[model samples]
Target: MSTTEKSNEKRCERDGREKVDKFRRFLAQFCATTVENLLLFDMGLCHSFPFIIIAALTGFPNKHNLNETLSLTPIEASWLASIGYISEPIGSLLSALITDALGRKVAMMVVNIPLVVAWFLMYSASSVWQIFLAIVLLGLGAGLMESPIITYVGEISEPTFRGVMIAYTHFGYSLGAILVATLNIMMPWRMVGLVCMFTPIFTTIALCFVPETPLWLLSKNKTAQAEKALCWLRGWVPKESVAEELQSLQRYSERYKSCESCIKKDQKCIHPLPTLAEKLKELKRKQTLKPFSIVMALFCISVFSTTFSMSTYIVQILKAYNIPMEPDEAAAVLSYVNNLGNISFLCLIRFTGKRYLYLTILSILFLSAAVICGYGFMVLPIGYSSFPDLSPNFPLENSNLGYIPFVCIILSSFCIFCGINSMAWQMISEVFPYKTRGTATGLTAALSYVLSFIGAKTFYSLETTLSMPGVALFNCIIIAFGLILMYKILPETENRTLEDIEMHFSDNSKKLTDRKIPKLDLSQIGSAKNNSNMPTRPVSIKGIDEQNNKKSGIGCDNRSFVADS
Candidate 1:
C-alpha cells in the first residue's frame, strides 16, 4: 500500500480527529526553539570579533607594520594580547547567575548593555593598547548572552526536538563569522567597530515578545503560570486538554518537591551526587561542571586546528606566494575573496546541504585543502618557501605550487563556515542533558572563545614554525578524530519524544532513533503506578512546536503488508 493508503486505513481505524490533532499540534510549537535560543549568542561576538580582527591585522607576531599599526614596540603587542585574554571570560561568569534567575530572554536583553558600551569604546580606540580595554568590556557582554540563550532555549524546548534547535544556534554562529568576514572586507577595521555597537539594538527589539518557557515555570512551582505559558505555546488545543497537561505538570512538580524534600529529610542518605533515583529526578544541581569542561576543551581543540588566523592573514599567505601585486592592492583582493567565501558559506546553509553531513563533508574538504597547501610549502626549499628565503619576501611564481594550497585554504574556510559549524552545535546539544544545558552550553561557548584565542595565536605561531601545508595537515588530523567519535558514539535523533529519549539514554541504547516509538509511554496508560505520588503520563501538547520536523530527517513510507494472515 502507498503511504496515503496506510494513513487512510489508520485514520479509519482511529475514528477520532481530536486525538490525532492533539499530537500533531504539540510537535509544531517546540520546533526550532533551541535553534533560536542558541542563535542569540551570535551577539557575544560583537566585542570579540573586533578584538580578534584588530589583532589579526596588526598584532600578528611577524608582520611588517606592527609598529606602525599598533603605535607600540612589538613587545607591547604581547602585553595587549594578555590583557585581551584575561578580559575575555568575565562576561561568561556574570551570565551564569542571570541565566538561571531572570531566564534567557531577560539575560539576552541584559547582554546588549556591555556590547553597546564595548563597541563605542572600540570605535574610538586610539592605540592598539586601548583595544585591550575594549575587548574586556566586549567579553563581559559575550559572557551574558552565551549561557542564558542556551539555557532558555533548551529549557523551553521539548526533548525530542532538541538537536535541531541546537543546530540552528550553530548556524547562527556561522552567520556571525560570515558577518565579520564580510564587514572586514566592506569597511576598514575601525568601521567594523560601529557594526558591533548596534547589534544589541536589533536583538533586544525582537526578544521583547519571546515567550517564557513553560517547563521552567513548572520547575519553580508556578503551576498556573506554566499552564498559561503552555496555552500560548499550544494554541488551539481544547480547554479539556489543558486540564490533562496541567495534571501532568502537577505530578512533575511534585516530583521536584518530593526530591527536594527527600534531600532535606534524609540528608546523608540521599546521595549528593546523582543517584539512580535522583538522577531520574535530575536532582543533581552541579553536574554541568564537568560536561562544561569537556565541551570547552573540544571547542578549543576545534578553533586551534582550524583557520580563523589564516583567513585573517589571507593576503599575507598570498603575498608569501610572491604573486605580483602591490601590498595594498593585494590586501584589497584578499579582502574581496574573503567576502566571497563568506557569502558562499551563508548561501550553502539554505541551499545545497544542511547541518550534519555539511559538517562532516566540510571537515574533510578543509583537511584535504589544508594538507595540500601544507605539502606545497613543506616541499619548497626551506629558506625561500617558508618566508624571508624567497625574494621580495613574496612568491614570484617560480614553482607556483604554493598558490595551489593558498587557494585550498580559501575554499576550505568557505565550506567549514557553513558545514562543520552546523555539525558542532547539533552534537553539542545532544551530548548535554536538558537541566544543565545552559551551564554546559555556556562553558562550551566560553571555551570556544578560548580556542579561538588559541587558534589565533597558534595560527600565527605555527605559521612561523611549520610550513602552511604542515599546519593544514595537523588540523586535518584533529577533524578526522572528531568525525570518528561522532559516528561511533552518537545516535540519529531526528525526532523522538522526551520520555522516549530519556529511556534510550538510560537503557544506553544508541539504536533507538531508528526504531518505532518504544513501549514506554504506552505502558503508562491505565497502570497502577499512575497513583497519587507520581503522574508520569505521556503529556502531548498539540499545536505546539515540537510536532514539526525540526532536523529535516528522511521519513520512511508508511505501509502495512501481511503474510499468512
Candidate 2:
C-alpha cells in the first residue's frame, strides 16, 4: 500500500476505536446507575426470606425437628406463616412519613435496621413468640422499604429504562426467595437465617455510596445538589449535559410547592391550613381518586390471585397436591421458575406496552389456575369435600396425575411473576402524581398488604373449607374478573413521562385551568438567553394566548411562549 493510503487507514481505525470507546462509556454509565438501584432492591431479599422460611418449617417439620424442638402447634404455624403481612400496613404508613420527611435514600437505609434486627432475632429465636416477633419485624421492614425504593427508582431512572428498573424489585424478591429455598434444602432453618442477616448489613453499607434522587433534593429546594446528583446519576456527565432534565424536575417541584398549603407557622401565609374535611375533599379529586382506585383494584386482584398465599404455603400446597417431586424440591424448583419469569418480564417490558403485557399475562394465569383446579378434581375422589386429613401420597394408579399439578404450578408462578405480580408494583411507582406519590404509594401499599394478609391468613381455612380444587377455581375466577376490569380501564404508559401519566388521570375540563404555573427566576432566564448552548422550546402558558400577550404589549409571537431556561 502507498504511505498516504496507510495513514488514511490508520486514521479510520482510530476513529472507529473512539466511537467504540464512547459507546462503552455510555453503556457503563447507565449500567452503574442500574446496578446501584438494584442493590437497593436487595431489600426484597430480606422481605421474602420469612415466607420461604415458614414454608420450610411447616413443610419439613419432622426433617428439621422443628416440631420436637419448638413444639409448634398447627394454629401457631399458620399464624407464623401469615402474621408478617398484617404488620406491613403499619410499616407502610410510617414509611410515607419517613420518606417524605427524611428523603428516599434515608428511608431505605433506615428500613435495614428492622430487617437486621429481625434476622438476628430469627437466628436466636427459641420460642414460637420469638419467631412471631421476628416475622412481624420482617414485615415492618418490608413495608417501610417498599414505597421509598419504588419511588426512588422511578424518580432517578430515564423514562426508557423505568419499566425495567421498577420490575427489578420483583426480580430481587424472586432471587431472594430462590436463594432461601435452595439454602433450606441444604441447611437448617436457623443457620439459613444467620446467613441471610448479612444481606441488610451489606445493603446499608452499599446505600451510603448511592446518591439521593435528584427529584427529592429539588423538592427540598436544594437546586445545586439536585444538579450534582442528577449529573452523577447520569454517569458523572457535565451539568449542562443534563440541563434539560434538571429543569424539568425543577418545574415539577416548583409546581407542587406552589400549590401546597403552608403547614409550618414560620412560613407566613394568608391561607389557613386545610381542615380535616377539606383535606379529605382534596383526596376526592380526580387525580388522586382515579389512580388510587386503579392501584387498589390491581392490588386486590394480585392478592386474590393466590400469589402471596402460594409463596407462603408452597410446600404445604405441593404436598397436599401429591406432586411427584419432594415438596421442598418442588418449592425450590418453582422459586427458580419464578425468578426466570421475572427475568423474562424485565426483557419483555422493554419492547411491549404495559397494558397489553399485563392483560396477556393475566389470561395465561387464568388458564393455568383452571388447569390446576381440573387436575385437583380429577385426582381427589372426594372433590370439594372437607377433608383436612387427606393423605397427599397417592396410590400407584394415580401417581401419573401428580405431575399435572406440578406443571400447572410452575406455569402459574411463571405467569404471576412475568406480569400481574410485577406490574402491580410497577404501577405503584408510575400512576401517582409526584406531589402525592409518597403518601399515595404508602396508602395503596398498606391496603395491598392488608389484602395479602387476609389471603395468606385464610389460606389454610380456605383450603379446608373449599378444598384444594376449590381454591384453584376461586383464583381462576378472580384472575378472569381482574383481566376484564384491566382491559376496560388500564391506560397505556409505555414511554410516557411522569407528568404525562398524571395528566392522563386529571379531569380534562380542569386540567389546563387548574395547572399551577411555576414562578421562574429572572436570573436563570438571563443566563439561559446568554448561554448559546441552551436549547429553546415553546411553552404554553394557561390563560395567556398570543392575543393576550400582544394586548399586554409583551411581544409579538406565536400562540405559545418560549421558556428557554
The best candidate by lDDT is 2
Tens digit of per-residue lDDT, candidate 1, span 1-565: 9999999988776656544553444353444252343334455245226434534444332233234354433234334443444445556656655675676667778778777777788778877656767777766666667676666654454443344445455445545645665565466556767876676677777677556666567656677777666665554454554554455444433333343334233221222433434433442332333333334444644565556545445544555665455333544444444445444544444333333555456466656655665565665445332333322354344556655655565556545544444444544554454444555565566656665556655554565566655666677777676665544433444444343333334332223223233433333422413233222222232122122212212111100011001
Q: Residue 473 in model 1: shift from native, Å?
A: 2.7
The lDDT values for all models are 0.50, 0.69
Q: Write the per-residue lDDT of candidate 2 for residues 1-565, one digit (tens) a residue.
A: 9999999999899778656544443443355445445444454555556555565454455265354365444566668767888898999988888998899988888888888899899899888789889989988988898778878878876655567667765777787778777887787788888988888887777778778888889878899999887776665667775665565665556444532433111122345433435544556567787778777877888889845675766676677677788888887898899889998998898788787899999988888898888877876655443223444444537677778878888998898889887888888898787657888888788888888888877877887678778888899889888987887777766666675566446533433223232222333333333332221122322123223433422211110011211
TM-score of each prediction: 0.68, 0.82
Question: Taking the candidates one at a time, how many backbone clashes does each contain?
Answer: 31, 0
Task: lDDT for model 2, please.
Answer: 0.69
Off by over 4 Å in 2: 1-43, 51-59, 62-68, 260-281, 383-393, 509-565
lDDT of 1 at 263: 25
After superposition of all CA atoms, the RMSD between model 2 and the true structure is: 8.3
Which stretch of 10 consecutive residues in model 2 shows the poorest summed lDDT? 556-565
